[model samples]
Target: MAVAVKKLKSTSFHGHKEWFTEVNSIGQLHPNLIKLIGYCLEVENQFLVYEFMPKGSLENHLFKRGPQGPQSLSWEIRIKVAIGAARGLCFLHEAKPHAIYLDFKASNILLDAEFNAKISDYGPSKAAAARKYVATGRLTAKNDVYSFGVVLLELLSGRRAIDRKKICTEQILVNWAKPFLGDKKQLFRIMDKNLKGQYPQKGAYTVATLALKCLSTEAKFRPKMAEVLATLEQLVNPKMTHFVI
Candidate 1:
């Protein structure tokens, strides 16, 4: 069942058409990605019919505060989400024809009623690819890994990507976090206070360490998306086989 539909932007109508063509070319059946049921071009409308997510974006879940407030996503669930997203990224990166996810952030991850994550914003993702080597290019598996790292940090620290007071210029969360993540002794200082010491310390440490690797300053240093998936799988299933990153 598709949820709300919005009109396409004037600047994006042409790009949207191109996106639709590319999506149709790929033929959607990816489990981790959102499915586009149909589109209407006659009306100059670009609507993507997608499964409804009652809980909305992961960004809201992590940052929003209300009566229903951003629930403290459990360590188990966070790890699950990490693996799920990694699976999605692996599919995108290694699958045929090689489609690259341009922008994958907490905001684009949608949660179904069951809280299973589905990566959305698929078709238009190509625009992200075209810009890859360009000065303005933003799409790359490494870039996606960077975004994923931010989400991972959010999971561990229960903090937003940017915290203003800690350092200058609204304090970039990743930079402030690097030194701490590298040091096992300084690890606890960055853990989410809300986690209440509930997570397995070593497991949490492993995850935080992985997140740092994903956010490496040199894109070449970041582990491949497949490796990331394997790592998270190892964290969850102790007996599962994995290669060292």
Candidate 2:
């Protein structure tokens, strides 16, 4: 089995030790979370070993090129990744005391050979959720739901969350996409062009609407990860009639 070793700064000995212990405690709790395999906490270097994801991170798939990741993901694969990520976050939220994954972004969502997505860098929430968590000095599971929305938007649009290369209006993905997300007629305008009109319109609309809900400024307005999972399942299997949020 392939393995990946991550190197952390050598100075933060106590921090690295805590992270090492935490990984051992939680890494194996779910299939969708990245599995930590080993570590090296030597005096000069710190390392974390994990199962090597052949497909790499979703960010690479969506934005970068060369050895970083795969070619543009197909519509079906994007939905599959989103569901897998939701499962990981749901597992965290269900913990006795929520193990909120602070970071929920495309780069942290790693994929394996079968295109199954697994979440990495568990304690780093960014974008809007990051702002809320830092501003209020409070972290909640709903914060994770917001970050998930950003990644979902990235998957749908095949765009970076913050692309400095783009014009000012398009640099911040959430801002640019929100206006179109809830409008059925405008939805296609923000969709990934790589999909080539192949995705199901109704399913796409459902996903877009769900994403918009997650992006709601009010933390309480976001759907729980379990509820989000239920919605995505319907897209995976149209016969699923039950929707719970």
Candidate 3:
């Protein structure tokens, strides 16, 4: 019933034609992706009907204020959400020839009635798994992993990926939290205080370790999506007898 309607006419005729075609070809995405039920492409008008996410975007939940989104999320719920997002990314990375989600950010992740995460906004940049990174000349998967790492850090600290006030410089979340990630002795300072020391210390260590791995300066050192998913699974069910040794 919910529809996303947008103007079909781009600034130029060329732009409009390109977008019109692009939207049409982006076929069935993963279930974890916000379901695109259908679309209508008429002259000068384009509309996409998506399964409405009553809970709304993860951005509002994690970063915004007021009645729309709460100030904090429970550690359990946060880990669950992280797992769903990871599963979605894993599907993309392992798809035939591979699918890449270049824009993997809090804003792009949506939540359904049960607070389940679903990735959205599958644009051209995300369609190809082998796209070259502009700066490092690596594959796009690394860039997506970097973005996901930033989201993980945000979830852990209950802070934005880039916070001007809390950060001493322009280094952002990773730079600000790097010390805490490596030094478990100072872990308490970096974790979201809302948890009130309720999280399992072992699980916390696992998550912190994964966050550091994802933030590794060398892209090659970052764990694959499959590895990330396994770690998150362990965090949620620590008694499952799977240790990341």
Candidate 4:
């Protein structure tokens, strides 16, 4: 297995060290979490080591399709990746004392050889230790939920969260897609055309609804990570005939 080393500058050493320590203690136990193999903290040097992911971040696969051709992620694999990442978030939010992943984004979700998604860059418990210090309301699990919803949008549309290259009103992925989420016909219009009409229509609509819920303007309306996981589980289960909401 390969290893990823994150070296911190001397100026940011102390804060990063504390963050590493927090993750080392609380994040290593989960299967879906990137294992903190070890760390180095010498006088002026600081570094964090983690298991290297072969397929790289979900962001790469989702938006960075190279000059070769269109390499879009299939609907089935996208759902699988979503479920795995959600499980990691569920574990963190349900842990004793509860941990908030303040920086949950597409770049933080890595993929293994089989394209199995694993959450990385959770930093430390101290990252969101103070609720009042957060710029967005409170540092709570719902914050992560909202970020996860953005990632879900990325998966569905294969678009960047913020694409300045696009024209105005279409630059922000969520804002451009939000208006279509409630309507099934409009939802299909926003889906990745690379998918080429191969995905399950009903399942896609279900996930679109879930993503909208996760992106709720009010945090209270966002489903808990556990609830999100359950919904994803049902979406991906082959035997699931009927889905609720």
Instruction: Rank all candidate structures by their lDDT, best first, as comma-separated numbers.
Output: 4, 2, 3, 1
lDDT value, residue 28 of candidate 4: 68
Each model's lDDT comes to 0.73, 0.82, 0.73, 0.84
lDDT per residue for candidate 2 within 109-218, as digits (tens), equals: 89999999998876422223444665686777788899989988998899988999999999999999999998988888998887777787778889999999999999
Model 1 alpha-carbon drift over 4 Å, by segment: 15-27, 42-44, 124-128, 131-140, 165-170, 238-245
Q: Which ten residues in a row have the lowest lDDT in candidate 4?
A: 236-245
Model 3 has an lDDT value of: 0.73
Model 2 ranges off by over 4 Å: 13-21, 67-70, 123-137, 238-245
| Superposition error at 158 for model 1 (Å) | 1.6
Candidate 3 residue-wise lDDT, 16-124, digit = tens: 4454355344435466766656555554655556677888877887778867545577777788889999988888778665667877899888888888998876645
Total colliding residue pairs, candidate 4:
0
TM-score-based ranking: 4, 2, 1, 3
Model 4 spans > 4 angstroms off: 15-22, 125-137, 239-245
Pairs that collide, model 4: none
Put down candidate 1 lDDT per residue, 1-245, tens digits, no spaces.
Answer: 55745466655545456767676554365667766656666545565556567878777777788696557777677787777777777787776656667777888887777677778876546645444544464446687777788888987888889867565843788877888887877888888766676777667778888999999988889988888788788888555333211
- Candidate 4, position 32, lDDT: 85
Q: What value does the lDDT take at residue 90 in candidate 3?
A: 86
Better of 2 and 3 by TM-score: 2
User: What would the TM-scores of all predictions be?
Assistant: 0.83, 0.87, 0.82, 0.89
Residue 54, candidate 2: how far off, in angstroms?
0.5
Cα error, candidate 2, residue 74 (Å)? 0.8
